[model samples]
Target: MGMRVKQLSQLRNRIVVITGATSGIGAVTAAKLAEAGAVPIITGRSASKLAAMRGRVSGRCGFYELDVTDNADVQRVVDRIATDFGRIDVLVNNAGFGLFERFEDAPLEHFAKMMDTNYMGTVRCAKAVLPYMKSQGNGHIVNIASMAGKLSTAKASGYAATKHAVLGLTNALRAELAPDGIAVSAVNPGPIDTPFLETADPGGGYAASVKGYLLKPAQVADTIVRVIAKRTPEVDLPLSAGIGIRLYGLAPRFADKTLGKLLNRK
Candidate 1:
C-alpha cells in the first residue's frame, strides 16, 4: 500500500538535477523525467548540447554546463541551483566515462582522467549538495554504476575501480544520511550501449563476445527515472544481471574461471 506508481506522480513539482544529460543514458533520462512531470535540470560539459537537450525534453527542463570533476564548478552550480530552485529533490550522478586497455599498456593519464571524472565527480557533487539536501531534510541521490562494479572483467580495471568507489560512496552515504531522511542508491546495469565504452580499444574479448545482451541508453534511462521517483535502496535494471552479480560475488575465483571460459569461446 506504500506509494505505488499512481502516487509517485507527486514528484511532478520536484527540482531534479541530472548530470551528463547531453547524451547517452543521462539525456534520455532527462527527457523521461520531463514526461514524468519533474523539472529536470540537465547538465553536461557542453553548453550547446545542454541547450539542444533542453529544447527536446517535454516538461520544465533547464540546462547547466557542468564539469562535475572540478570542485569549484560543482559548488558553483550547486549553489546556483539552491539559489534558483530553493531545493534539489534529486541528484543523479551519471557523469562518468572509461577507457579500455591492458593495465600495463594503458596510459596513466587516461586512468587518472577516469578516476577524476567517475569517482571524484560523484564525491564532489555529493559533498556540494549534501548541505542543501540535508537542510531540506529530504532528498534522493542516484548514482549510475555498472555491473562491472560488482565483478572483475578484462580491460575494465579502471572503470571498475571508479564504479566500485561510487557503490561504496552510495552505501556509506545511505547509512550516514539515514536519520536525515535522505536516500542514496546505486543503479547497476549491464552492457548498456552507451558512449562510455566507445574507447579506442577495449582490449578484452568478453565485450566483443556478447554484443547482443547490450541494452539501449533509453532503456537504462527508463530504469533510472523509476529509481528517482521511488525510495528503492538499490535497483538492478535486469533481474538476471542481479542474479549474476550475486553468483560472482559469492565465488570470485569461480567467476573468473567462467569468465576465462566465456572469453575463450570468443
Candidate 2:
C-alpha cells in the first residue's frame, strides 16, 4: 500500500482539469487527485461552490465558474488553463445532470438542456482540449457516463440518451486518439449517493428504492483517480451492476421483462 501510494504520488504537480466539479463524484475526485499531489483544476456552474471546493482542496488547485453548455466560455476557460498551467495532463468530463420522469410526462425543454450539457457539453470540452493534448503528444480524457447508458431504464429515457451519446463518444475517441498517445476512458457508474439524485429524482421514488445500492461519491472518486494512473479503457462500478448490464445486453427481451421492470423505479 505504501508503494502504491508512492506510485500514485508520482503525479505531483500534474494538471488535471475536471468539469461539473463543485459536487458529487467530481468534487471528491478533485480532492483525491490533490491528495495524490496532482493539481486539480475544477470547473462548475456555481461560483460559491467552486470557491468552497477550492478552499477545501489541499495543495495547488484552480477553480472556475463555468456552465458546460456555453461553448464559447468553455473554449475560453480551456485556453486560459492551457496558458496559465502550461499543459493539461488530464481532462475528466464529469459535468452533467439528469431529470427523471416518464417520457410522456417529462418536459421537452429538460431533455434539450440535458443533451446540451451532458452530451454536447462533453463534445465541446473535448474539442477545446484536443488541440493542446494533441500538440503535447499525450494526455488522458476520462468521461463520467452511467449504467443508464448501457441499459435503458424507464423514467430516465432522456438522461439515458445523453449518457449513451457520451459513451459512444468515449469509445470512438479512444480508438482515434490511441495512436496520438492520448488515452480516452469511460467510467460508467450505477446510482450514486449525491445531489445528482435530488435533481434526477425530484420525487424521491428512485432514490428511495435504490437506497441500499447507491455507490458512494468517494468510492467513485477513488476509481477515477485509479483510472488516471492506469489509463484503463472502461470501468463499470459495483461488480454486480456490471454483471447486470452484461446480462441485460445478452437478453434484452428477458431483461425488459425482469431487470428492466426492477430498475424502473423512477
Candidate 3:
C-alpha cells in the first residue's frame, strides 16, 4: 500500500455513520472501513442504492435512506443509530451533488439546493451526532469537500460555494469540538473517477478536460479510511491537488486565468 496505515486499535467496532454511501467515495470507503473492522452504517437518498451497498459491504452493515436536507428525517435516523448502535465514533458527512449553471444566469433555486445538500446537509449530520459524540467524549467528523472549495470554477460556481461552506464548517467545528475530544476534518480532493463526474458534467465535458488528472474513487476512499483510522484532523487525498488548492487561494486571478487556459474556456 502506498498510504500509511496508522496503528489505531479504536477502528474496529467504532460505529461509523456515513452519508452518501450509495456509491462513489462513500460506498468504497464504507466497504474499506468494514474490511478494516468497523461497523459502518451506510446512508443515501436512493433506497435501491442504499440496499445494494449494504448487500455488498464486507460485513453485516446497517442501512438508512437519509435525506439530509430534511431535519426530521436526519434526527430520526440519528436517534435510531444511537439507540441501536449505542455510540458513534465517526460521522462522514459525504452526501453532495450539483448542477453546472452560470452563476448569474441561473435561478436562485439552484444555489438554494446546493446549500441545502452541501452546506445544511453537513450541518445537519454534525448537529445530529454532536450530542452523542460530546457525551462519549470522543468522535471524528469527516467532511467530504473538493479542491473547488479552496479553488474556483466558472461552470461549477454553485458547487464550489457549497464545498467552501463545508470547509468553513469543518474548520470552525474543529476548534469548537476540540475540548470535547471530537475531531473535525475536511477532505479536499481533485477530480475523481466516479459517477460524480457524470453528475457534475452530464455532458461528459468534465471528464474530457480532466483526463489524465482524474483519480480513482477507491484511491480517494482509501485516504478517507486512513484519515478516520488514524483520527487525522485534516486530509488532502492527493498532495498535488492540495498544493493546487493552496496556490489557487494565494492567487485567485492567476489560478482562474490558468484554469481557463487549461480547460480552453472562452
Model 3 CA deviation exceeding 4 Å by range: 1-9, 252-259, 263-266
Please provide, for model 3 over 199-253, each residue's C-alpha lDDT reduced to its tens digit, 9 standing for 90 to 100. 7778887688778888898898888887887778887757976776678778878
Ranking by lDDT: 2, 3, 1
Candidate 2 steric clashes: 0
lDDT of each: 0.82, 0.92, 0.85
lDDT of 2 by residue, 125-234 (tens): 99999999999999999999999999887888999999999999999999999999999999999999999999988878889998999999999999999999878899
2 against 3, candidate with superior lDDT: 2
TM-score per candidate: 0.92, 0.97, 0.93
Ranking by TM-score: 2, 3, 1
Q: Quick one: best lDDT, which candidate?
A: 2
Residue 26, model 2: lDDT of 94
Question: How does residue 97 of candidate 1 score in lDDT?
Answer: 86
The lDDT, on a scale of 0 to 1, for candidate 3 is: 0.85
Query: Which ten contiguous residues of candidate 2 have the minimum total lDDT?
Result: 257-266
lDDT of 1 by residue, 54-165 (tens): 5788867667889998889999998998888879999999998877666887788888999999989999998988899889999998898887787656677788888888
